[model samples]
Target: MPEALAILQKYWQHDTFRSLQKEIIDSVLSGHDTFALMPTGGGKSICFQVPALMNEGICLVVSPLVALMKDQVANLQNRGIKGIALTGGIKQDEIIDLLDNCQYGNYKFLYVSPERLQSDWILDRIKNLSINLITIDEAHCVSQWGHDFRPAYLKISELKKHFPKIPFLALTATATPRVKEDIITELGMHNPVQFEKSFARKNIAYMVFEVEDKLFKIEQILKKNPQPSIIYVRNRKSCLEISSQLQTLGFKATFYHGGLTSREKDKNMQLWMEEKAQVIVATNAFGMGIDKPNVKTVIHIQLPENIENYYQEAGRSGRNGEKAFAVLLTSPSDSIQAESQFINVLPDKAFLMSMYNKLCNYLQIAYGEGINEEFTFNLNHFCHKYGFPTLKTYNAIQFLDGQGIITFLKEFSEKITLQFLIPSKEVIRYTSLNPNDEEIILTILRTYPGIYEIQAAFNLPLIAKKSHHSEAEILAVLHKLNEKGIIDYHSKNNDAVLIFNEIREDERTINKVSKHLIRQNELKKEQLQSVLNYVAEKNTCKSKMILNYFGEKATTNCGICSYCITQAKPKKDFSTLSNKIMALLQNEDLSSREIQNKTKNTADDVIFVLQQLLEDNFLIIQNNNKYTLKT
Candidate 1:
C-alpha cells in the first residue's frame, strides 16, 4: 500500500484513492468479483492498475474500446510498467510471445479487446497463466440496455467457467439502475460490492441555445466564451464540415471520426494535445481515454443521444476543476430529430427479420447455413445496393447486434514494431537465415531494446530518425525482415473483412427486443429533462440539478449558472410577451428565423405574435421564405 501510494504520488500526483477505490481494491484483494460504477473522469483505471501491481500474478483486463486498450498499454509502458495489449494492430505471433511473457516472466498486465476473447488460441492459452484479477472495462456494454453496446462483451461471463478462482472486476462510466442490475446478474458476480460516484461536474455550466442558423450560433458561442473547446457533431460529414468552417474562421481546428486513417487520427490527436489546435470537431469516437485538462468549453452542435453521453462529453470540461461551459446549440427541428433517432431504435420483429434477410439475401446466403458468417459490411454500399435509407439501415444492424444475432465493427488495422531487440545471432540462428545482405535484418533489432526484458511497442519515427533513414526506408526494412524469418508486423489499414466460425445457428433465441432500446428511450427523455431543467431553473443554483441527476444529494446551489446569472433581474414583465409590437419591430423587419432566434420564449408565443402582426398588418411575407415590415 505504501509503495502504491508513493508511485501514485510520483506519477499521478495523488496521495490516496477517491470515493470507493480503496474498498473496491480491498474487495479484489479478498478475491471477490467487484463491479465499479465510477463516472467519467473518475478513477476507473487506477482501481485495477493499483491492484495489478500489488497482486501475485498478472491482471487480464478485457476492454471493448480498441483505442483505449492500446492507450492504456502505452501509458503503462510509458510509466515503466511491464504491460502488453493484444490488438489486431500487432502480428499474431507477437501476441503469442506476449502471452508467453505473461506466463513465464515479469509481465504484470495484459489488456485485450473483448472481441479477441473468442479467439481459439487466446481462449486456450489464457488459462495456462495465473491471472489474479480479471477486469471488464465499460461493463455496461455487457448489459443489453446500454447506448454503446457491443456483442463481444457477452463472453466475459464465460471467464468464470474458465477461471473459477480468479477475482473478477467490472467497471463502467455510465449505467442506469437497470443496467447496473443487469451487469451483476449477467456476470454472475459473487456478492459484489457496488461503488457509484457522483457524475456531476459542478464547475461546468450547462446551457442550451435554440437558433435558426446553427453555424452562426456556433460562431457566436465561440466568440462569447472563446476558449479551448470541442464541438461534437453526430456524423463524420458534420465533423468535417464544422472543422473546416472553424479553420476558415481563423480558429486552429482539427477533426476526428472513424473514417480517418490511423496515421491521420494520431497526427490530429497530437496537435490537439499540444494545444496547436484549439478546437476539435469530432464524432463521439474522439473522447474515450483522452485526459485533456484545461478544456474550457464543450459544445454540442447537435444534441447527443442521451444524458449519459452528454454528461461524459461535458465532464471532459472543468477537469482541472476550474469553471468551464457546456453549451448545446439547438435547432428547431431537434425534437423531431430526437424522435427520429428513437424511431430507429424501436424496430419490430418483422423489421429485424427483413433486415437480416436482406443482408443474407444480398450475400446469397442460405438460411441457417449462413450462421457464423463474416462479411465486410460497407454501410453506404449496402444501403445503396439494397436501396435502403441510410439511418434506418444502420439502426437495423444495431438492433440485430443488441439481440446478439450479429456483430458489426468499424474496420481496425494495426501497425506494430518491437521495442525488445533480440541478439543478431539469435535472429540469424532462430530462423536459420540464408541471406547476409538483408537490410531489414539489422534495422529491427536495434530499433527495439533488450529482447529478454520483454519490451512492447516503440515509436516508428524515433526508430527511423535514429537509423538515419526515411520512413519508407524503415518500412521496407521491416517488410524484408518480416519476410526473412526475423520479425513480424501487423498492418490494419486494410479493408474490413469478416471471418465466420462454426457456421452454426445462434445458440439462443431473443425476444428481438432489448432493454437497451427501452433504456435509450428513457435516457433521451432524461436529456430532454436536463434541457428543461436548464431553461426553467428559477433558483440561482445550476449545480444542484446536475448533482441530483448523478444521484448526489447536494442540497445547496453553487450560485454560478445561467440561472444565477439571470436571477438578479426583476422578473420579466412580458406578461404576454405583450410588449408593444413596435418594441420587437424596432429593428428592421426581421425574418421568422431571425425573430425566433432573438426571443427567449417558445414557438407558440413567437408564432402568436407573428399572427397578431399579420392581424394588424404589421408584417409581410415577401419573396418566398422571407418576412419584412409592411410597406
Candidate 2:
C-alpha cells in the first residue's frame, strides 16, 4: 500500500480514499501547489492530513474559524497525534510555549486562525518550525467574491515567502468560478494542480414547497420520514419555538443556536447524534464540524441568506449514500422577509464608515492611537448610546472585523455558581413534593460533589443531559430552587471583547477597504438573488440548478428532485380534468379526495385543476368544506 493509504488507514481507519481524495493527496505529496474543491462530507481534511503525516515535519493549517481549528486539533489528539491550536485568547507567553512544543515536541499539525498570521512575532516563530506542507482550509474566504470573505485570509499568501519550497494546499467545500480564480491568484500559487469534484449529491432529492402552514408541512415530512433530520431556521427564537412545537406534537426534538451555552450545545448535539432525538432544529451555526452520515432530511424552514450557506447546510444530509431530502419550505411572504432580512440589513460603505467612526468614539480611541487596544464591548449599550439600529450596527462591526480593521471576539464567558442553602433532608422533601424537578436537582447534587458544603460551579448542560432535560428547564428549576432558598444560584453573562487591529484613522481605514465593502455588498445581493431564484424557479431540476451555480454544467437532470418528480408524471389535460370535476361538483359538493377518487386522477393533478377552477370563479368551497359549482 502507498504510504498515504497506510497513514489514512492507521489514523482514520478508512480502507480507501473517497473520490478525488487520493489524487489530491498525491498531487500535494508530489510537492505541487494543490487546490481541492470537494463538496461537504467529501473528506477534504484527509487530502491534506494524510499526506502531511507521510512528510518529515509538521503541517501548518490556516483556517478561518477558531472552532474549526479546535475541532481538527481535538480530532488529531484523539488519534494519538500531537497537534496544537493557537486560537484567540491565548497569551503571547502561552503562544510561545505552544510554538515551542510544535517546534520540538514532535507535533504533527499546527492549526491557527488566519487572524493569527498577522502577528509578526508569531510568524517569525512559525518560520523556525519544520513545516512540510501549508494547508488553507475554507480557502474561499480569501476571495472577495466568496460568501464568507475575510480580509485576514489574504495574509496567508505571505507565508509563501517564508516557506517558498513547501507545497501549498487550498481546500474549500463551496466556491463559485469567480471565487475559485480569486483564491488561486490571491494565494500566489505557482502552477497549482486544481481538483474539483462535482458539487452534486446524487442521493439527495431536492424539494421545495410553497405552503400556507409551514409547521404542518414539517409535521407531515417528519411523520413520513421518521428518521434523523435537521430543520434549519434563521434565528434562535425559531429554533426554540419550532423544536418545542415538534416535541409537543410527540417527536423527540432538540434546539441549538449560537445563544446556547457550550455545554447546552454539546448536550443537545449529543441527543441528536445519539438518536435520542429524532430532529434538531437549529440556526446556521449548528453544522460546522458535525458529520452525521445518517441525517435523512435537511429541511430549511426559512430562506437561507445565500446559496452557498444553503448548499453547505443542505449537503449535510444524504452522506451515507441513501436517498435523503433537502427540503425548503417557503410562503408567499418569505421572499419579502428574505429581502428585509438579508438585503435591507447589508451595511453599505457609508454605513460601514459611519459605524467605524462611531465605534472609535464609543471606545474613546483618539486619532492615530489605540492600536492593539482591547476593550469589553456591550453591543446593546453602544447601539443605544448612538441611537443606531442594532442589527445594521452589528453587521457593520462584523464587516469591519472581516476587513481586519478589528477583531471581534463574540465568545464570552458565562459564570454560574450554585450552593445548597437547605439541608439534604429538606432538599429531598422539596424534590418529593415537586417530582418533576427531582431528576434535575438530583443530577446536580450527584454531579457537583461539593455543592452541599460550598458554592460550586456546575455544568448546566451536563446536568440537563443526565436528567434528560433541556438547559432552559434546568435553569428554570435552578431559579425556582433559588427563589425558595433551597440553593444559592448566581449566573453572570459577560460582554464580548473587541480588539482594535488598526489605529483610529477612521475615514482612512474605511476608505482603504471601500472597494471591498462595495464589492462585498454586491456579492451578497447577487447570492441572495440566486437563492430567491432557486426557490422561485419551478421548471428546472433543483440538483442541476445547484450544480450549475457551482460552475458545473450538468448534462442530465436528476430524476429525484421535486421538479423532476412532477415532470415525470404524464402531463394531464388540465382543461378536460377541470370539466369532469365541474360536472361532478354541479351535482353535489365533494372534497378534494372524493374528487380524485371519482375522476381517477392523481391527487396533485386534481388539486391543480380545482385551484384553477376556483381562481376562475367557476367553483366554490361550501361550508361543508367541499367543492361546489357556483349557484
Candidate 3:
C-alpha cells in the first residue's frame, strides 16, 4: 500500500484514493483475483494501474474499447511510464514488435484487444512475457447476458490455463448480478475478492419530461443549466441536425457519431473537451474515454435501448461529484420508435444465417479461405447492393460478431497511410527531380519512420504544417508519388472494420451460431422492457429504480430526483379546486389565473383541475381562452 500510494502520488499527483480504489488495488497487490463493480467515472483504471506500478512485471490488460485503451496508453506515456496498446489496423509485424518490447523492454502495461487473443501467434508471444497481472476492462462483455456481449471476451478464460498463478482483475462500469456471476465463472476466477461500489450517483438529479416538443425541452434545459453538456440522440442524422439547430440557438455546439471520419471525430471531441464547444450533440459513441469532469447536464432526446446503456450514458454527467442533471425528454412516439429500433425488429435465425452469407459474399470470400481477413465494411453500401434493411442488417451483424464468427469494429483511426515502394535514396532522387514534392517527401520521412518497411499512419495537418503546404497539395503530392511508383498510398477513410474469423460456411454451420441468436433476442427483449419500465415508472425515485435494477438496495429516496421532488411537493387537494372551477364556470367564463384567484387555490391545482375538466368535456375553452361549462 505504501509503495502504491507513493507511485500514485508521483504519477497522478493525488494524496489519497477514491472510493474502493485502495481496497481493490490492495486486493490485486496481494495476488488475488478481483472483480470490481464500479459505476461510470468510478476510476476503475486506477485500481489496476497502481498495482501494476507496484509489481515487477508487465500488466496485460484485455479490453473491448479501442478508444479507451488508446487514451489510457497515451496517459501513461504522458506520465513517463512505459505502456503500449496493441489494437486493430496494425500490421502483424507491428504487433510482434510491440509484444517484443513488452517481453524485454521492461514495459509496465500492455493493453490488448480481446479479439487479438484468438491469434495463436499472439498467445505464443504472451506466454513468453513476464506477466504479473491481467486486467480485463469492460468485463461485462464476457457474459452473453451483458448488453454489449462479445464472444471474443470468452477466449480470455483460456489464459487462466496458461498463467494460473497470475492474478486477474476484471473491471466494468455496469453489470448486474447475473453478469457478475457469469464473469466470475467464465473467467475462472478462484475465490475472487468482489468489490461493488454503490451504483447511485446522488449528485445527479434525474428528470424525465414527457414533452411533445423535445427540441424545445432540450433548449429550455440548456438555457437553464450551464455549459459543458451532452445531448444524446439515436441516429447520426439527428446528431448533425440537432447540433446545427443548437448552433442556431446561439450555443457553441458540435456533433459526433460512429459514421464520422477520424479527423472529424478528433476535432469535434477536442473542441468540446477544451471548452471551445460548450455542448456536443452526439449518438451513444460520444461518451467512452471522455473524462470532462464538469459536464453539468446529459440530456437524452430519445430513449436508449436498455437500462444499462441509459444508466451508463446518463451517469456520464456529474462525474466531478458536483450537482448535475440527467434529463430524458421523451414523446409518445419515442417509445414506439425505440422499441422498433431495438427490440421488435431483431433478426431471427434464418435472417441471421442469410445475412452471414451475404456478408461473406460481400467480402468475396470463398469457402474456407477468408479466415483472419479483415475488410473495410460499409453497412449502407452493403444494404443497398443486397436489398437489406439497414436496421435488421445492423442487428444481424451484431449477433454474428457476438458469436465469434467475425469481428466488427466501428472505430478505426489508421487512415492516411503511406508505404514507400522504393528505397529512401531512390525516393529522394525522384523528389530532387520534382522539387515541388520534395518537402512532403522529406516531411513524411521525418514525421514517421518505417514507412519503407510498412504502411505508416500520418496526420495530414501535421504533415501540411511541416511541409508548408495545404492538405489538398499534400494529398496531390502523395497521389503523384503513388503514380510514379515511388510510394504506395491508401486514403479516403473507412469507418468500420470487419474481420471474418472463419471462412464462409453453409447453412448448417451458420445455424450452429444462429441458434444462440434466438436466446440473445429474448435477452434483448427483457433488457428493453427493463428500460421501458424505468421510464414509465413514476412512483419510484429514478436513482432508486436504477440502483434496484442493479440489485442494490436503496434505503431511502434520493429526495432530489424528479420523482422525489414531485412526491415531496405537497399534493394539493384538487377536489375543492375542481368544485370551485366548475362553480365559477357555471356562473361565468374565466381565464385559468382568474379561476385560481377567485377559488383561493394554488395555481398548479387550478391548472390541473382545468385540464381535467377540459379532458372530461365538462368545460370548453373559447377563442378568447376563457373556460365555460358545456351547455
Best by lDDT: 2
lDDT of 2 by residue, 1-631 (tens): 3488789889889899899998998898889999989989999898888888898899999987878888889999899999999876677799999999999899999999888889899999999999999999999999988998998898899999999999999999999999999999999999999999989899999999875558877888999999999999989889989999999999999999877767689999999999999999999889988999999999998999888889899999989999999999986689999989888988888888888888888888999997778887888899899888888888888888887788887765677998998789998999899999998888888888788899898777678778899888989998988988888889877557788877988778888988887888898889889999999997899999999999899999999998999898887668888889888877888987788789998655776787788889998877665888887
Q: Which stretches of candidate 3 lie over 4 Å from their true place?
A: 411-493, 573-631
Clashing pairs in 1: 89-414, 145-516, 413-492, 414-492, 419-449
> lDDT at 606 for candidate 3?
70
Q: Rank the candidates by lDDT, best first.
A: 2, 3, 1
User: Could you tell which candidate, 1 or 3, scores higher by TM-score?
Assistant: 3
| Candidate 1: residue 483 lDDT (0-100) | 74
Best by TM-score: 2
Lowest summed lDDT across 10 adjacent residues in model 1 is found at 501-510
Give the alpha-carbon lDDT of every model: 0.71, 0.89, 0.86
Structural RMSD, model 2? 5.1
Better of 2 and 3 by lDDT: 2
Look at candidate 1 and tell me the lDDT of residue 449.
Answer: 45
